[model samples]
Target: MRRRHLIAGLALASSLTALSALAAEQGKPTPTTKEILAKSAPAEWRRPDPQNLLVMQLPTGRVVIELAQDFTPLHAANIRTLVRQHYFDGLAIIRVQDNFVTQWGDPNDDENGDKDKIRSLGKASKTLTPEFSRAIAAKQPWTPLPDGDVYAPEVGFSGGFPVGRDPASGQEWVAHCYGTVGVARDVAPDSGSGSSLYAVIGQARKLDHNLAVAGRVLEGMPLLSGLPRGPEPMGFYADPARRTRIESVRLAADMPAPERPAIEVLRTDSASFAALIDASRHGHNAFYPEPVGKVGLCSLSVPVRDAKPVH
Candidate 1:
């Protein structure tokens, strides 16, 4: 009986080894994110519309944001107006909540701040019909992830932004992924004026479908996330001196042609991007012998690169 059992175990091991060899012969492992990007075609990249690009100059470096006008046109327009009016210029980054957000706006707008010192909104509307979520448009680019979400019925990328969707309601909203920029508001839904904004330093998925996502930060996230956390509750800085001052905020359209940021973003609908998604799911290497077959909505980051000068 012992001899028979040993022979059976040996046969099973031989079969497993054969299966492994067959699998290796059938397909090569998915390329790494870096390798996939290196092979991407120039057509896979897109230059953002100047009107939708915001250049926020900070003490450390420049932070570029691309407004998702298709999702929240009103908020985008309002933010554009505020930017044109220089509403954010000279304002300070008032809060840096650990593992939450890096908020920037008029310091006087806070609970501990002097109401009288609040900066004027100028021509921008003080209140807007809250654009928390909008009806999903069929024409919009949709790169759906097979892996289901915890919050919404489905999750995907629309126009380079991580988005959550509910087919039952036909509503889609931007997910609060890392580097997502959201409009700050009071309890009242109409209170958001696009004057104050916060960038997610962590995956604050709970905020999805709750806050209006103004845009996504394309560059200079380290400058925003690397700041010291505030001593006050909710990351509000008690001492004004701790806040980082905003040098200026300008729309790319307003800048000189030569001075505009020479940058491009990988198109979410491009083949390279789809490869990236697959790579995130199944790519394996020496370090990671086993690939995690599922990828979350916020785990993917659309690639951005400095545009090569047209010779």
Candidate 2:
């Protein structure tokens, strides 16, 4: 009787093992984002130049921006000067117009704050030549997107920035997709001096020619995008108490090596980058049996990752 019970137990265990195997087989196999990045070669990643990197420390976290120096050189230079002069320190995020922009600068410039106490731009220029768009030439690196664009004759990326180009007009400018930082100015075209900047937190593509895109947020977009929406018109926070203050803005070059944000951005020209784009462009999963094969220009944000210091 004991031998019989032992045999029965062994049979039950075998049956349960087979059932578990079948359950595992029932699930579909899909390669995740993490898996793809893991397979990327070391050479596929590039570190941004310290000279062009802006480290904005907010109350919530650190936000890293890569200045689009190629498109807005003068604004880039002035912004760097302003950072070195510490012009952005203690400034508050004044407006968070939902689906528009998260603006920051001197609250004094706004109707809500004391205008007399506005911070000076110091040695930085008060105005710069408008860099709204530049002539697209053969010398520039080009990686055109696969699908047709709605706003421009062609859409693609160049130097890590999403670009909209008109071959006929020979003009190319950065798009105002999420995390794009633009220089705010008055009615005049050349009024932007990089003193006041706004990050694109919503669909503000209409502001393309109306403003100048100076940079793209490389990291910490959540710190800007996830903030509570302002109550006033155009998303301005009516209550000054509700605004988030800037702790400091530092050029990565000015910071100590230990203090800098060490990150690796996937090279848009690399084969791995092409693979990444193709993954989304040709992705098919259990949930999405019919692949959405075409990806929009704005949706093609290159992947960025934090990296350990080289020994």
181-223 per-residue lDDT for model 2 (tens digits): 9999999999999999999988888888668898999999999
- Quote each prediction's TM-score: 0.90, 0.89
lDDT for position 36 in model 2: 67
Off by over 4 Å in 1: 1-30
Q: Once all C-alphas are superposed, what RMSD does model 1 give against the true structure? A: 8.7
Candidate 1 colliding pairs, count: 0
Cα lDDT of model 1 by residue, 1-311, tens digit: 97865553322111112223344335533344566678789999999999999999998999999998888899999999999999999999999999999999999987788999989899999999999999997798899999998998999998989999999999999999999999999999999989999999985999988889999999999999999999989888989889999999999999998888899999999988887776666544333445465779888888999999977
In model 2, residue pairs whose N, Cα or C atoms come closer than 3 Å (at least 3 residues apart or on different chains), thus clashing, are 97-235
Candidate 2 residues lying further than 4 Å off, grouped into runs, are 1-30
What TM-score quantifies how close candidate 2 is to the native fold? 0.89
Query: Lowest-scoring 10 consecutive residues by lDDT in candidate 2?
Result: 10-19
- Give each model's whole-structure lDDT: 0.85, 0.82
